[model samples]
Target: MGNALRFLYGGFFKPQSDEPDSLGPHGVTISTVGVSALAHDLSQFDITSQVPQGLSQHVVSSKKAQTKPPPKTPEDAAKLITQTLKNHEKADVEVHTGHLAFYGLPLPHTLVEVETSSTPAYQPQHWKFELHTLPVDAKAVADGDGITVYVDARHRTESANVPREVHESAIRRSKARAVKNYAEADALQKNIVDAGYRVINGPNNDDILVRKYRIRLRGIDAPESEMPFGKQAKEELVKLVQGKSLKVCIYDEDHYNRSVGDVYCNGTFVQEFMLKKGLAWHYVAHDQRPEFALWEKEARAARVGLWASSNPEKPWEWRKNRRNGV
Candidate 1:
């Protein structure tokens, strides 16, 4: 007959004190016992003789063993659980003691939740956008920030309309100095022009002054000094402003050192008038005046100054094309 020896890891296993002893059924007796082969309940918890480097095998297991989960160390796991709670819709899981579990075993390895309250942080940087109106150089310099943004152009602000006498006095004062050979008179005339006003000289120096308001001729793109319409443009401007009163609004100067403004005579904008006369074309590139396009249409229709040419290019386009050698 063949003999078999079996060891009983009991209900109370003294892992440390009770050294490995051969087993009998009663009172820790050493004997040969027949191996009872019923399917050894493989599902129930069992204590193994194996122990980790720092831990002891005296560790206990119970029916409640399945209830107490092993410790979790992954920081990501905790974060994910927090996020899950934040986004929890149905509230299927409950938090017990800081450990999160669905049912009993830890949730599927992939399940992650996000915190709704904490959003990603972001910082916007300084950037450039187009403006409807050219920016004032002084403000641009002071702001020290990037250029002012505009949809198409800068919004024009309303201005006060000075009386004809005020303009006349300015011009007469300048002329009197010019007649006296005092340089102040010449300087006065220059100031008036720079301020978008003009002084008209009379026959006997006791002349009527016609000041055109809001005329930024210094910045307008007229024909070059020697160009056919350059002199005409100046003459035309003098004629327009000399006898007429206009509603003028001033604006900032551009890189070309041109002061841009809106000049109106009898509520008719002088820019529109000039565009129709073909004496000037649109001077802007990125930020264009509102009337730029409309005046272009009018000029095209009337075959005004530049439109007389078969394919007269706009000044901005011409300059750009010249730069690109196209």
Candidate 2:
């Protein structure tokens, strides 16, 4: 064990020896003597000084006084400490705090407290967050907490999949159409089916409703499935909702799985976006016109996408004509 003492009242690390002791900031006399297998100089040292224990401290050198080394800047101290720790190949490290005099100078300095830990870097899992029809319009609502929900709906069948409730609900909704009851069950089946649910009637009267969403294609609204954009719409619908869990609210459903609900992807309303993007025209009979006023205005102003045609017929009108065998 090696021991070294410091005296900083005179602005340098003057070693304390057989001389009288001096007072420190705490009003205690700064003097120490220790002998052990693991004691170190508790004082900060000059970089020029070979670490104290490297030489013999037992010699009393009164003939020619040993002068202190140059003062160290905070940056120098930091670099020196880091390098010392890295290069200290021979000794087992032990540390202790020393008196302020160990600094050897009375300069008003700002000591920054730095903290370090050996923690692994964090990696966030990429997730999809979406919102459905809320009180606010799609344009009015912003992302990042506007009724957004996190769902792990995967494109492939995997262990880490969507919530069980989402899957089960989809299966149940899909299977409801297969049930033999057409009278009372029709409306219920339509409601779920229209809400982008795939109803499958299982054995033993069980039903599974799997959710399949849709995409709206650009241009030409064919009559439901026959109109130009009709198939494109269905295909787009599949892109938007199939294999993806969505928050949906239905006004009604066609005999097919075509739903009348507004769809949302990642907190953004797909239906409103489609309408605004001139992908789909507004459903006339279902005149919740207020909800789509902004989108209609946008489509009209752009004169792009589906609105390229001067006087396009509505899907309902086309469907009526088809039914009438015209």
Candidate 3:
């Protein structure tokens, strides 16, 4: 009986070569070749079994956990903003205090303290923050000293405050476009523009929503449209900024509710350009920057632009006369 058992074990469970053996049932040794053959045989069977209903559901839920819906509450919006900042940090993007203000978020304590501590150069004592605007359209130039700008809404805190009707209109516009309804989409876009917002093509050809702002160039006052050199001033400004982006450091809001800021384009100070070109006057009453007066003096000495008239009428004076029906 013992000899018969040994023979059976050697045939079925013993290692077939000098290779290591894999442990089988009851600590019995099985050769690799035998295991491979067994696996092949098992593969021939219906091994493509469906997962148990509960386990499959769990997997579907795990996938769902990877995504989240848009924020619907103030708390959720705040959390999303925090997450966005974190993501920006992770991507090595610079975050400025002014950027926070531009987003309509509260300034950080450190920034608030610094801002209140002392005045900085080229910035007014009441200076608020900077705004890096999107590209400006030719029609956005109201005059040499004023422009209508748009700020991207994707990262702005005020986006949370966007009217529900605007969002619904945008949604409808998108659906209309998807359905090839061009007229409906255009009409919806008109409504959005009337609400102080617009959808424009982004760098990647994607649609981007932006909010509007009227900006008044600080430090100088350009001639009125009807004044001498007025058309030239507007033309010069359009040539400088049409379809170009700008950096605006806001100081205050004017009576017209336009943001009064120092505008820079391609590293050129826009107010300086207008002053040096003799297209505008140094509005000393509003801004008493010595550089502005110096630029105006240089332009006057060169007898360029409005300075060619020797004693050209100022825009303010022109407006004053118009107001008095002179």
Candidate 4:
């Protein structure tokens, strides 16, 4: 260890010999601690020699300090964001806040959103997406007790590998999207086949329903986010499940990979709750359930919830009109 310590000392290494074969040092020496000489000296001893007892474990300093990583390119940023999302359990990631700055791509993403699963909150907690790892050139700011990240987006091409969940996010993002708009990523394409269901703690103590993946309450259609009662409907859904856990009967996945199924709290059908309150409509075109349509009728006759409107439009019609610029 003493020899090793001496070998590591600055004065040990001399400049290399010009002869290359000569063990003797050569070259115009400045400091006696040149690296080439140390190598030559150390080679004479047993290469596997152990460190002496009580030798300091502190790292010897290098002449040059390490350089910081290059500023993250939009491509690099996108990849990092995707990998970050992919590595975690979907339920664990939380994107509360952030913003992305597009770099070289001519994407409509000038206003693109990255969405994931939502953990419905009633009291408005200050936590959004709490990414386990931080991205480059981005800083996390303390915002109202939560964090808001700002990223500089700079990429030349759309990385096909990134998941849609990270890039073209939908309005109802999962917990993966607890984000405020700082970066992007892509979701893995997983095919579903009656994997089964699960229940978890939502923002409150309620039993939030889940399958192997996110589920869209089947046999019914709620207002689109832009529809008149859309915001209210979402708030209402959040409230309904606020202090409740759910029992889900998952049927299948929509074309978008979301689960479409029935939800029951205690013994009460959640879809029925939504309809009775006029928060949703029976989606007759895709539904196979018999009782759902019956509930819609009752809500309609009562003139309660949305049915109170003299001529309330079904949710699907509202969506079609919006797509057609109605």
What overall lDDT goes with each candidate model? 0.38, 0.37, 0.65, 0.39
lDDT: worst 10-residue window of model 3: 112-121
Tens-digit lDDT string for candidate 2 (100-130): 2232222112111111111111111311222
RMSD of 4: 29.4
Q: How much lDDT does candidate 3 score?
A: 0.65
For model 2, state the Cα shift of residue 251 in Å: 4.4
State in Å the error of residue 226, model 1: 2.5
TM-score of 3: 0.59
In model 2, the Cα lDDT at residue 306 comes to 53
What lDDT is reached at residue 42 by model 2? 30
Of the two candidates 2 and 4, the one with more favorable lDDT, higher being better, is 4
Worst 10 residues of 4 by lDDT: 96-105
Model 1 misplacement above 4 A: 1-220, 255-258, 313-326
Tens-place lDDT digits, model 1, residues 1-326: 00000111121111223443332211222211111110021111123322112111212344343354432322332333333333443222322212332212123232332221121111113111111232122222111011111111112221234445456557567667657955666666676656544455444664333323212432235554344555566566555544443343444555644334455444454565566677776665433533354445557767877677867655545556768997
Report how far residue 5 has shifted in candidate 2, in Å.
Answer: 85
Per-residue C-alpha lDDT of model 4 across residues 1-326, encoded as one tens digit per residue: 23322422222122334533211111112222324433433343236443222112211222221122221232332332232223333221121001011111111222122211221211113222111111211122111011121111111121343333433232222333345332321131121112222223444664332323344766678776666666667666665554444544445657876555555545555676777777788878986443455457658878877788888777778768878998
User: What is the per-residue lDDT of model 3 for residues 1-326, given as tens digits with 9 covering 90 to 100?
Assistant: 12222222333233445666653212334446544432332233225422212211221122232244333332333343333333333222122222233323333332222221122226445778777789889999988899999878765544776788888888888889889999999999999999988888889987777877899998899998888889999999999999888877888898998999888887777888898889999999988765466568668868999999967998888899999999
- The better-scoring model by TM-score among 3 and 4 is 3
Better of 2 and 3 by lDDT: 3
